[model samples]
Target chain A: MRPLDWVVLSGTLAFIVLYGLYKGRGSNTISKYLLAGKTMPWYAMALSIMATQASAITFISTTGQGYVDGMRFVQFYFGLPIAMIVISSTSVRLFHRANVYTAYEYLEKRFDAKTRTLASIVFLMQRGLSVGVSLYAPAIVLSVILGWPDRLTTLGMGVLITIYTVTGGIKAVTWTDVQQMLIIFAGLFVAFFMIIHLLPPGISFTDAVYLAGAIGKLKAVDAKFDLANRYNLWSGLIGGTFLALSYFGCDQSQVQRYLTGKSIAQSKLSLLFTAMAKIPMQFFILFVGAMVFVFFIFVRPPLLFQPIAMRDLESSQVQPRYAPISAQFDRAFDERREAALGLVDARRAHDGGRRAQWLGQYRQAQARINQARAEGAGVVQQIHGEKEFNDTNYIFLSFVTRYLPAGVVGLVIAVIFAAAMSSSSGEVNSLATVTVIDIYRRHIRQDAPDRHYLWASRVSTAFWAAYAVFFAQYAKNLGSLVEAVNVVGSLFYGTLLGVFVLAFAFRRVTGTAAFIGMLAGESAILATALFTRITFLWFNVIGCAVVIVTGLLISWLRPVRQPVAA
Target chain B: MINSTFMPTHRAEMPDEPPPILGSWSRIYVLVLVYLALLIALSYGFTRYFS
Candidate 1:
């Protein structure tokens, strides 16, 4: 990075932090600290909700997913709008009318305290583990940018976010999320246009699109009904809906965002806004990745996007084996580039025969490229002893730091840091809220004064922040940070969603029945994860179904107690 | 009927006023669902056209 880049990066971060600290002033009481005094407008909460979900990994890895796996992944969000509508019509009013500090608190009012505690603990565990991955996402940025160790970067980011979050509370998290969301949008637009402009001269936007389509990068939907397939339309609609319902309706990190809205209408509006905008936003990000893939067709990317991995492979004993693979990769890239250009020309000239020929050649060249990449990955595995070696998370960052101009590179990096901080702050803040409100205050010191609880909240925030940093120190070995975080959430979200579904839909299900059903649901999900080839998305569905069925069965089998004569 | 006392009485609160744009909350929900269906259809078309 140049001097100007550092100036822009530091300047943007400093302005955001200062603005957050300023806006977050006067959060003295627990309610003000945790919920922004329920005074946030719909737009602010909407942006905050978006920013929370769109973590640094969303930018860094999702674009890479688009490049490597095509846009079929967009189907994963097909269920999200439906989930939002359901939550808006149900949970939004439920939580707001209850005037609860956390989603789990609603569980106590709806079910028994045991169910509430069980749900709270589930959230804390899932969110706590995922928060580390969130912190690890931006740590990858600083590690790549400055060549600092990932551990040190994670530590630094954790401390910086913890300070602001513990001091200003959700007010800081929400307001700063708004600023960060704006910056993130700006960075994305700039990077998208830059990718288009950086394309080879005479390649119009339509040509670029056609080239991406030719290479299969533009396949955004798959209509197949296979359950094992992760991103098909059926999985996206059914399994994805369950996952989204668990995430938005039951997860505290998201629940807290809308809960801060001044009124029920405002909360519903915020969610509806997300439903309307999220798919298009994802399309834009994935489209950026597809463009990057096209750009690399002309400009050869490294055999592996991760520079450190490549450097290690070069110096390892497997270097001899890797050399020929690198050569073949270069040859394949050149051939693919030629085919792509020829295909574009043939299409422009309306020659179907020539177009078919070039398309055949293009697919063949792509096969060769894939073969070379597989060989390279094999060599890297030999050197690193890590079987699931993937360089996808490095693709976007490698592009930004190498290709973008100085100021813009810094802006994109700032966008990444903003995403990381926004997401981590919300997770850490929510973790603290659940710990204090659900566990500490409810179970430990029910009669404590407001000031005492507020102090405990800040302290718990720091505790969870430190824990995330500690866990992130080891999170670097995880293959894809985005998938890793989601997988962790999926492992637990099903049972949590199941319990919530029971509370909402089945009044006859007793608390004991619901609690046991939740345990059954969790066990079933675990078994599925361990012994089946089903995709992780389906875990949510399996879990919710098991919980509801078990709860109802147990409720039916139990003997009804006779009421004493009045 | 199952015991009513065991069931918690925390019913969802109804809004005093109608939604800002839509005439009612149900309409707003329907509008959102309709938008979602349109989005899915468009995405399907985009995929088929491209692939």
Candidate 2:
């Protein structure tokens, strides 16, 4: 990046941290630290909710995902609005009325102390690892672009977020997140328009869409209800709804966002705002990725987009053997581009026969290009033996560095950093909230003054921040950082959502029955995950069913003469 | 089974009518139903536009 771009990047980030500290410096009470004194209005709450969910991965890998896999990935969020509605109707009011600091705290009051601990443990395990991946998502890109070691980048990003988050707590996180999200949207809008403006002359936007569609990049709708299909209408609706409920309703990172609202009505409205905006925002991001995919059709993209992968090959002992394969791939790419351009020109001329001929030829050329790219990937993998070799995450970054103008490049890079900070800050804040509220205050040092716990919140924030950074350094082996996080979430979201459902809807189930049901449900989900090849989204549905059935059955078998209030 | 002339009495006067509990969750069903409708509509609209 140029010096001017670095100035913008540094200036934007610095302003956020300094602003958060300035606004939230005098937080002396635990309520101020954890719930931001319940002073936030609807707008701040809505944006914070979005920012926490829209990680650096959303900005970086999502575009890349669109570029590689097309817009089909947008189907994953098809269940979000419904999930929001469910949570706002049920859990939102419940949490607001209970006046709890963490979501798990409600579990204890509604169930038992042990159940709360179990839920908290599940949250910590999932969020901790996810926070690590969230940190790594942007670190990998920045490190590759700036030529910095991954460790330095990870530590730098971690420390920067921890500064404001530890000082201001939830207030800092929500306020900074609001600012960060604004910048993120601004940066993405600029990049989106610039992409359209940069498209080659004589190729209309409609033509570009047609070409992308022809290549199967626009397969966003699939009617089939195949269990293995990850993102179809069926899985997205049913499985996706459960996933959303678990994520937004139960996850402290999200629960903490709306929990800051002053009134139940305000919190419900805030979530409703998210419900309305979430899909459009995601659509925009995925569309950016799709446009990036179209952009690559005309440009001569690299055989291997990942800098690390390319570096390994360039410096390896097998460089000589790999040189010919790389050349072959480049030749195929050029041929494909020529063919695509010919098809575009034919369409412009309004000649049906010519257009059909050129389109057919372009299809064949595209096939050859895919074959060549695959062959090159295999060679690269063979050379870097025993290592994961997917480059989908790096593709969009490569495009920005290689193709985008200098100042825009830096702005987009800053956008990525903003996304990383937005997500990681939320993670650290929630982790600290749960740690201080559920574990520290509940179990240890229960009678300590609020000041002691207030200090403990800051301490825990720093600890989790450091832990996330450490985890980021070692997560390179995990293939597809996006999928890895979701897979982990899938493993636990269902069971957690089930437990919550049992708490609210099934009044007959005893606490013991619900607790045992959750354990059994998680075990069943994990077993299915291992033994079957069903998509991760379905896991949510299965797990929820397990909890409801088992809890109800156990209740029926051991009918309490008089039911416990909890 | 009651005749048309058998009118229901007010809760304060009638012995059969139960008193309203302070936090009886009488509104929860309506709230959940409304929310469920919104979720379905929103999700459907998203898929239609983006897909």
Candidate 3:
């Protein structure tokens, strides 16, 4: 909001968008417009792919996760590398050899048009449903932390994305994503070092690590196998792999990124690079969150990271019930800070006995601190009359705005906006591609001129952008919106992945069998979601299993009736 | 086999090329997997050391 912050934010955004437009300048034909003329190098596609997967909200919330929970959540990506390898070997070569514009377009070649249409519709529904939430949720969170209007945030993001996407096509989106990612890296590094430097003078980085580990913040690996436990090694490796396959293999947005690669080797390389990069990237973000937690140990954080919630707690209506909780939080904060210093001193003296006593005291104070924080949440909940409340996502946002210097603040904010735009642009672009290539050109007018479809793609991109902005405004009041969006994507990915699995892995399965199996898989996943308490990650497993079994059974009962036209 | 009449038959099938660094695609894949294993091991070590 300061003059310097404004300059940095605006300048950073303007450069990324303009750079995207410049790089995408030659996208006149449909091929270049949709697939970047199949000339993109591996690195650009790799970063673009990563950007699309990790959005603005993802960045904010991940750091917040580290502050509140711990590094255990990183296990969620254990399966990603495996999924990448699978896709690199199978879908990369097949989609390249098939020379398809979208992944669903290849389904039409392997299965029937109905199957392709269904797969495309599934992607459209899942991606289209979530894109608005992805764009708006982060903007609203930023609005709360930075005191900006949410509508304006969403509008600014939508406008910047539309300008580059419509003008330069996928080329614009990819290159701009590259810039966004690079800036995001800069912002992250700056934020990380700032947190380290801001730590209490007595605490070295080693001490900080020891302190975080003592508090269980560095528990990055959980080997215990539990079905419902979200971040265990098994679920992350198994369930995570299924979700990643659904994402990178069946999802048009990701498939389209690598399809733009100059050759199969480049496309596969892009995927492999992402496989190597994604986990470390997530670790860095979460580690930043852990550092933020360490910084707040000596310097007290607010009862809740959400400022509006804090102000609401000050209101006369809530103040009577909240005062005692506020007092308790202050007491716990002092006790925790003192205990942390004592523990540090004990460790420096190599006094194991004193370290144990101080560790116990520190954890007790931390527990009390958490309790007060919960009571604050309860008061906030009373105001909203919600079932449950969490201010987890605001931890890092509040930290960045309050502590970081002015120019750096703007850069970090721009990094967020860049993430939002990069993610949204990819989804919006892919939505348009699937629309024009899979639906409009495939069904409505198969013989439309290339120029006609090119214009259609542009028009569709604008429409989705406008639609995302409009939808984001109404999405503000919906509770658990991020989880809802994630669930929506997971709901369909399994069945979608199943159909593709049948196409590639089971060549004996007929188109009718595959199509019928998809319906069965969809129904099974929906039933599982509604009737069972199974975690959403396992939804992909169940859906894929049902589809494969059903497809095989049906194919076994039937024979080929007619030859496919060639 | 499915219908291919409307498929873009005239579009040349891009030949698969070996990775620039690894001697073969299989070798590259093994390297990536090995790298993943190494990352997991390091993360586990960090957890153990700190916790």
Candidate 4:
């Protein structure tokens, strides 16, 4: 990156951290430290929620997903609004009324300590690993832009976020999240407009959309009912809803965000805002990716978008084998560009015959391009010995650093850092809260003063931050960072959501039954994940179903014991 | 027996105020669901139109 890019990136990051620290002042008490004294407004909580969910991987891999796969991925969020409404109505009110610091705290009030502990451990296990992946995602951006090693960048980001989060607690995290989200929005709008601006002058927006649609990249939804298919309407609605329910309702990171709202109404409003905005926001991001695809169609993109992988391929023994494919890919791109332009002219002139002819040529050229890419992927796999060698996560970043002008490039990079920090801080902070409130204070030192618990919170935050940095060193091996993060969540979220569902709806399920059902549900989820090819989205539904069913059956088998009044 | 010491002060009071804009929490939730439906329909239209 140029000096201006460095200036913008550094300046934006510094301002966010300082602003977070400034807003986070006076977090001395445990409640203020952990819950921001329940004073957060709807807007702050809403942005924090959005920022936490939209990690750097969302920007990096999603746009690349748009380019390579199409916009069907937006359907993955179809259940978010529904999940938001459900959670706002049920979990938000329950947690707020109960005056709990963490979601698991309420599980104990309804069920038993064992159930709450089990759920909390599951959260730590899933979110703990995912936070590392979140930290590792933006390191790819820094690695590509400044040629910094991934390890150093990950460590740097982890430390910076840890410092602020440890000092200011959730207050710093939430307030900075609001700022980071604004930067992300600015970056997204700038990048989208820039892509349009960079497109050849003759290619109007509608013409570009036509080309993208002709090549099957503008498909924002698929109404097909296929369980095996990952991103269709059915999976998105059912699986996505279950996932979002688990994420927004049960996950401490999100629950904690809304829990900081000034009142129950504020919390509900914050979540409802997210419910209304999330779908359109995701659609816009994916559309930006689609536009990036259109942009690359006019300007030749690299055969493999990952620069490091491309360099490694050039030096590997497979270079000779890849050479012909690279040449073919170039030839196909040239032909496709010509056909795309010709199709636009034909459509303008109202010549149906010529339009059809160029459309066929464009499609054939696209097929040839795909074949070349497939060959290149094979070469990459052969060289790396990794079968799932996908460079989708690197595609948009490659475009940004190589194509965009200097200051904007920095702003985009800042957007990435902002995302990484916002997400990682929330995760680490929530992890710390769960550890201290659920485990440390509850199990270890119940009678400790608020000052003691506050100290433990900071220490726990630091420990989790260090652990995330250590785990992030290994996140490089995980393919498609976005999918990797979600798959990891799916593996655990289903069981967590099931436990919450049982707690909320199944009043007769005893604590023992719920606890055992959680174990059974987790086992079933694991079995499905190992033995089946079911899409990850269904894991949430399957896990929740198994837990509820298993809990109910176990409860029915046992004689109902009258509740011993506490 | 399950421990009670870990539990916070349980004051499961009703929310003090109604929803600010929609006048009721249930109405706000319905509006969100309706918004989701409209979004999906529009997305489907976008898909079909583009295709």
Candidate 5:
């Protein structure tokens, strides 16, 4: 990044932080500190919800996911809008009516103190680790680009988010999210336009699409019902729906966003805004990745995107032997480029027959090119003695650093930083809320005054922020941070969602029944996650089903226990 | 007996002051239907276009 780029980056970040601190002015009480006095409007809630969910991982890794896997990943969101509507109608109203600080509070009312404590514990563990990944995801890229240690980047990002969150609380997080989201949108649009501008003279966007399609990069949907295939339509709809429901309905990070809405209507409207906008927004982001595929079709890409992988390959020990494979990869890339260009010309001429034939040839050439890259990656694996080597996480970062103009490069990097801060801050806030409201207030100091609890919230926020930063230091070489965290959530979200659904839908099921059922459901989910190769999204379905079934069974066998008094 | 206070608010009284922030079932129904239709339509279009 150049001096001008640095100026743009620094200026954008400084403005957002200062603005957030300014809005965080009136927060003194616990409710104001944790829930922003429940005064956020629909737009802020919507953008904040999206910003929290769309971490730096979404921007950096999803684009890389797009570059490597194509647009099929967009199918994962097929269930999201539907899930949003369901949650809006049910959980959204219930939580607002209860006016509880954390979602787990309702569990205590509907089930028992033990059930609520169990649920809150699950949330704390899962969200705490997830917050760490959100912190680390952007830090990885900054560390690579700036040639700094990962620890410095992680600590820098973690501290910045923690300070503002500690100062302004939820209000700061929401207001800053509005700014971060705008920068993210601007950065995306800029990247999209620049990609179109750089395409070689003879090719139109359609031609590029057709060329990408020839090699199967345009595969947006797969109708086959394969449970193991994570991104297929059925998995996306059924599994994706459960995952989204568990996330938006039950997860505090998202619950906290809508909970801050001034009224239930505003909360529902804000959710509806997200439900309507989320899929299209994700599609556009994924499409940017697809365009990146087209961009690389005209140029050469590195064999491996990870700096460590490259470093290992470039070291004196392996460079002599790796050179031939690198040369072969170059030749393969050049051949694929020529073949793709030829197919593009054929399509442009409206020669359908020749275009089809050329497309076949082009597809074969591209596959061989991919095989060579894989073979090259395998060589790096052998040299380094670490078997797992996938550079899908690196593709977009490599493209941005090498191709994007200098000033825009800095702005985009800042956008990634803002995204990391917005999301990690939300996670930290939610984690702190759960820690203080669910654990500290409920179990440790139930008689404490509002002012004491307010101070405790700040203390918990700092503690969780420190914990997340510490965890991030150890999170190296985690393939696709977004997918890894989602997978982790899938393992638990299903059962948790199930517990909540039972809390609402099955009134007769005693707290004891639901509690026992949740335990069973959670156990089943963990077992499934461990022993099976079934996609992570399916875990939500499993968790929800097991809880419902186990809860009912337990209720039928044992006399109903009375619900705990709030 | 379960505490009366923890019981859901009386259905009759709920509508009188009807909390200003309530989700409408009718609206939710319509929204769900529309999105379901769009997903199907989009899927069909993408399949046909790709085919």
Candidate 6:
């Protein structure tokens, strides 16, 4: 990283931390610490929600996904608006009227304590496992790009976020999220326009779009319906709806964001705004990736985007295997670059026949390029002894550091750090909130003073931060960090969603039925994940369905009993 | 369960008011869903045009 980049990165992070600390000053009570005292405006909460969900992994890995896999990943968000509409109507009012700190806390108000406990444990487990990867995913890429140690990067980010989040609490987390999100928006705009500007001479923006489309990188929607197909419209609408319901409706990280809102209307507005905004934001990011793919069509990219993997590939032990793949990759790059130029020239010449001829050659060369890259990844995987691996996470970063100028490079890196802190801060804060509100106060010490729980929340915040950093140190290749994080959530989120569904939708389902329903839902998800070829997105659908059906069946069989008032 | 001090005493009565726009919350929700359908349509257009 250059001196200008360092200045931008450090200066931006310092300002955000200080600003968060300033905004978070008055969080002395349990409510204030966890929910921001219900003082947050809809705009602030909306941005915080976006920032928290748009983790560093989302920012970095998603662009790389666009470059490698086309824009199909965007279909995954088609269900978000539907989910938001569902949430705005149901969960928003229910959660607001209940005046709960965490979403799981509402479970106790509706069902028995065991059901609430089960939901809380599931959230803690899912968020805990995924939170560390949120930090680690970007750190690994930044380490490769900037030559910094991944461990030090994770530790430094963890410490910087902890200072504000632990001190200022959710207030600190939310306001800084607002700031970070604005800056992230600015960074994305800069990166998008700058990448387009860096495209080859004589290639106008329209021509660049044509090139990306010609290679199928611009295929954003697949309308076909297949259960195993992960990103088609059907799964996105159906399975994506379930996953979004689970994440926003049930998870504490998201629930805590809205729980801080000024009122039900404000919180509802926040979610609806997010639903509207998230898709365009994601499509733009993927478009930026598609543009990066176009950028590399003219400018040569390394055979392996990750530097460490590249070095290991060329080491003495692996060089013999790596040489053939390297030669193949180099040849493919030359052919692909030539065919791209030919296609562009044909477009400028307005010759449809020549365009088609060039397009065919362009696709053939592209296939060869993809094949060479796959072989290169195999060599690296064999060298590292990892089960499955790719450098898809490194594509965007490698493009930025190599091509973008100094100040913007720093800004992009700052955007990354800001995203990491924003996302991890929310996670750590919610993890602590659940630890204190759902588990500690409810089960362990029901009569504790607000002052006592306040201290426990602080202590718990520090503990989760420590745990995230420690886990990040060990987090390695999980393919694309964005998909890995979501997959991990799906494992547990389905059952969490099921419990909430029982609370809100099925009025007569008993607490025992709900509790047992959770077990069935989770077991079904686990079995589906282990024994079937179904994609991760369907896990939410399967689990929620199983939970609801089981709960209904059990409720019918059991004798009627007076339920405890929540 | 009898400890009142365990809860926050500063706030009470979470009131749900009508949305500032569209005259009501349900209207606002319909607008959002309509917006979503349009977005998917546009996305499909982008896909079809590009491919």
DockQ for all candidate structures vs. native:
0.45, 0.05, 0.46, 0.41, 0.27, 0.32
Query: What tens-digit string does per-residue lDDT give for candidate 6 at A1-566?
Result: 78998899889989998999899999998889999999999999999999999988788878999998889999999999999999988888888877788887777777778888989898898899888988898888888888899999999999998999899999999999999999999999999999888877788999899989888998989999998898999999999899999989998999999989988899999999999999999999999999998999888799889889889988999888988998988898899989988998998899999999989998898889889888888888887777777677788888888888998999999999999999999999999999999899988999978999999999999999999999998877445555666777889989999888888877777788989999999999999999999999999999999999999999889846553557
Candidate 6 at A234: error in angstroms?
Answer: 0.7
| Number of the top-ranking candidate, with DockQ as the measure | 3
**Interface RMSD score of each model:** 3.7, 13.8, 3.9, 4.3, 4.2, 6.4
- lDDT against the true structure, per candidate, is 0.87, 0.79, 0.90, 0.87, 0.82, 0.88
For model 1, residues A1-566, the per-residue Cα lDDT tens digits are 88888899989888888888888899999999999999999999999999999988877878999889878888999999899988987788778888899988987876678988999999988998789988887787569755978888788778878878988999999999999999999999999999999998989889999888877898987887998788998898899899999999999999999999999889989998998889889988999999999999889998888887788767757678888998999888999999999999998999999999999998999999999988888877877677677778888889998899989988998898899989999999999999999999989999988899889999999999999998899776666655766777898999999988887777777778989999999999999999999889999999999999999999889945645658
What are the per-residue Cα lDDT tens digits for candidate 4 across A432-501?
9999999998798999889999999999999999999998898777666556667778899999999888
Backbone clashes in model 6, listed as residue pairs: A109-A566
Model 2, A153-185: lDDT tens digits are 788889888899999888988899899889989
Chain A alone, TM-score per model: 0.96, 0.95, 0.98, 0.97, 0.96, 0.96
The window of 10 residues in a row where model 6 chain A has the poorest summed lDDT is A477-486
TM-score of chain A of 1: 0.96
Clashing pairs in 5: A264-B21, A265-B21
Once model 2 is optimally superposed onto the true structure by TM-score, how far is the C-alpha of residue A29 displaced, in angstroms? 0.6
**lDDT of candidate 1?**
0.87
What TM-score does candidate 4 get on C-alpha atoms?
Answer: 0.96
TM for every model, in the order presented, reads: 0.95, 0.90, 0.97, 0.96, 0.94, 0.95
Q: What value does the lDDT take at residue A469 in candidate 5?
A: 95
- Give the native contact fraction of candidate 2: 0.02
Candidate 4 residue pairs in backbone clash = none
Clashing pairs in 2: none
Between prediction 4 and prediction 5, which has the larger DockQ?
4
Share of real interface contacts recovered by each model? 0.44, 0.02, 0.58, 0.49, 0.08, 0.50
